[model samples]
Target: MKQSTLSEVKSAVTPRATLLVIGVVALQLLFVVSYVGALHEPKLRDVAFGVVAPQASVEQTMQRLDELPGSPLDPRALPDEETARRQIGNRDIDGALVVRPDGTTDTLLVASGGGRTLSLALDSLTGDVLEAQGRTARMVDVAPASPRDFNGLSSFYLVVGLCVGAYLCASILAISAGARPANPARAATRLGTMVLVALAGGLGGAVIVGPVLGALPGSVWALWGMGALLIFAVGAATLAFQGLFGVIGIGLAILLIVIAGNPSAGGAFPAPMLPPFWEAIGPALPPGAGTWAARSISYFHGNAMASSLLVLSAWAVAGVVITMLAAVLRQRRAADAGSSAAEAGATEPPA
Candidate 1:
């Protein structure tokens, strides 16, 4: 029997298919909203800044800089230019100004390696303020980025690649075997497999970015180790999601890593330059933590990195626990069902 076009369309798209399409649409819209909202405006918000001046003039300098419109720079008084340089290297502050006691010129110490965009913003803002005071601002690069590391974004891009590799490897494992592992052993096997993938992919990415491309200058061994940790963390989390929610878990992984994690990761703009929401969440997600750690390794002499490393560790631990628990629970349910079926058959007479 021939059917009308509308009837054929209705038959082709079941209720489940309609719902899946709706879910995809929602994710697409969220991706667009998150990326644009985080990057559209690149205004600095309370960037950590230090002022080095004589005791008598330090308070006035701090007050005037603080009073800048939008409160762009969070200024504090430092004892000497030496302290300013040390703090910038420690990543406790982004840039510092050393006000000369004898001359009208002030030296601004900025670390381009932390992020070129952020350092440039610091320069422009400080330059404008010094110009108002009729003093010249001399720019000094305390930790300039490697020439090949364009815009100092290589660290961020490398972490993003690791995250993508993590999820894709986990998804492929799920497709080849099963979304939910049948038992604890199978779940463990999947995790063990992910670790190998992490190691191989991590070393490959580190070598490419370090020696092959010269995109970043850091200890290749340190980068390789961190890369492995990041990949396993993300891959384990994806496996956990799949164990709990079957095929739909892939979407959840994308929602967390791609739509929510990427823009908020501070890859394009540092956290302080992003909006309040993105800035707040960026440090808490995998992509953000990985990006910050990578940059610390490459530029900040591995300073102030304890918190980011802890975050990645937590994700890896949680994923392992959840995946194993889900598989064990599923195994128990199957065993109980099988036992009940056998008992029922043993009591029944021939039919």
Candidate 2:
């Protein structure tokens, strides 16, 4: 009985099944590692900061900021406070330090609308430095966040919602039909369906966040366009993954887009404040790119979003190419197999 039971267990756990189990375990470990690694430490790095002071003091202050260890801030001297405020409003700089000529106190201008965590970090860092020099600093929010937008996270959540909608919808479509499309025509049809779904999902998300909820402020049209692009890009990528790897491709998409992409997205903590690994990979992933673009639309007047848009576009293009190519190859193989079978039948002996 013991020998029979051992044989049964061994038969149940085939090599292929074992490998798949191993793969799942690896993905699980990676999910934990990626999230923890990216979010464990939040430190400032290369934050663009403006300085407003007299000609002589401007250079001196900038020099002092440059000399800080790790070079956390990229400080530039603005001609006056008005320029500093204008630049902040335009999203040219993250924050500014204005030195009072007559007193030891200074003013730090921040925009919590961009990111509350980042603004707080700037305030803390500036305050510490000023305190060390026996000076005091007051924080002024140049561009405050909307009361509905807590921690400036509305944009991030909005993007994340769109991303979820995209991948989930694509995965369902693949599952309902064949994992790999039946043929080129089927693939085209699946892609076309995805496009329409993305368009509607994008517009709906934009409307909910902008008009219905008033959680985010921006051109609703621009947000709609961005949402559409983001949804299509993610959905197409998921489709491509399913075509290439079958059911396993769904896991691969989750690993890339959810496990790795979400934390690195700078949604909870801006890229500058995240650890190095997360910060480096953040802009390349769909979630990260989408979050950045959404924030730009909300707070930056859509400035500095070209790179993000390009990244999303690349993903969409690549997904379409891969899906179509995979379908074509699959169809060719099926046709060749059928032809070979017919030839074999023709040569067979008569019963």
Candidate 3:
């Protein structure tokens, strides 16, 4: 009997266990590919830059910037120096070159907090232009980064932490109960739990990143809201996947959040610095949107907050709908099976 029981246990564990291991391997491989591919070469090209000068100098400056080799700078002429500064602060452009009225010296305004690559690119490109005109240039870092925000990467780490917590918590939720719950009520409870978890995660992350670590400087409440929404959206999506796909759902969550999301997130490189594929998809996905929004909130004047919130909301709603539907269908099937078995048993003769 003991041997038979052990054999049965092995039989039960073998298929799913093997599948789970394979899924893990696949996820690990994907993680390596995504991270390496996205970050292997970090260079800036076609970064939006502004040029400001008198009418006589404007044409020459624009031409020089446009003709810069490697096409690193996409410079457009601004009407005045004030406009250039405004645009840079609003994130409309990365940096600006201001030509003096006397045409002897020029000034370059750059936001170092945005990215060091872009700032350095602006400096190099502007230096070339000024040298050609026999004029010198000075750099002014208008939007300087905090000393603690190394590479402007703290926001990315904080957001990733929240995302990881979300999906892991979701996986735990599935394991504690059935992957596909029996009814909408249980699905609703799961959602409620997710919300609670989101609240804790958001507040904890905000406090840690702000007061404890001094990594990010932003309104605690604003960061808290963003963190909560980000976590809940990721968790809800993971739960929906588990509901629809069983144990494979955890693997799928990892594939989406870690493998696909991280590299395209524009954490290491801003949008313009990424490859075509990552640049195109970065703004549309959760991680990318979250990163952009986090940066905007912390640095910019909350310009892109609304759109980010909408993207997160869409994920949360879709996850809830799919989870509830899957649960309802699963319960109906179980009910039908129970009813049919009862009827057949009642009609059959005794064994």
User: Which segments of model 3 are wrong by more than 4 Å?
Assistant: 1-13, 67-70, 128-136, 340-351
CA lDDT of every candidate:
0.91, 0.89, 0.84
Best by TM-score: 1
lDDT of model 3 at position 260 = 87
Tens digits of per-residue lDDT for model 2, 1-351:
999999999999988789879889999999999888888878899898999988877898898888888888999988889999989887789999999989999999998988899999999888888888899889999878788999999988998899898999999988896777778898888889989998899899999999999999888998999899999999999999999998788889889899989999988888888887788998999999988888888877888789999999999999999999999999999999999999999999999
Residue-level lDDT of model 3, residues 190-267, one tens digit each, is 989999999999999999999999888877899999999999999999989988998788889888888888888878
Q: Estimate each model's TM-score.
A: 0.95, 0.92, 0.89
Q: How does candidate 1 fare on TM-score?
A: 0.95
**Alpha-carbon shift of residue 175 in model 1 (angstroms):** 2.4
Model 3 TM-score relative to the real fold: 0.89
lDDT of 2 at 166: 92
Model 1 weakest 10-residue run by lDDT: 1-10
- Check candidate 1 and list the clashing pairs: none
Ten-residue region with minimum lDDT total, candidate 2: 177-186
The candidate that wins on lDDT is: 1
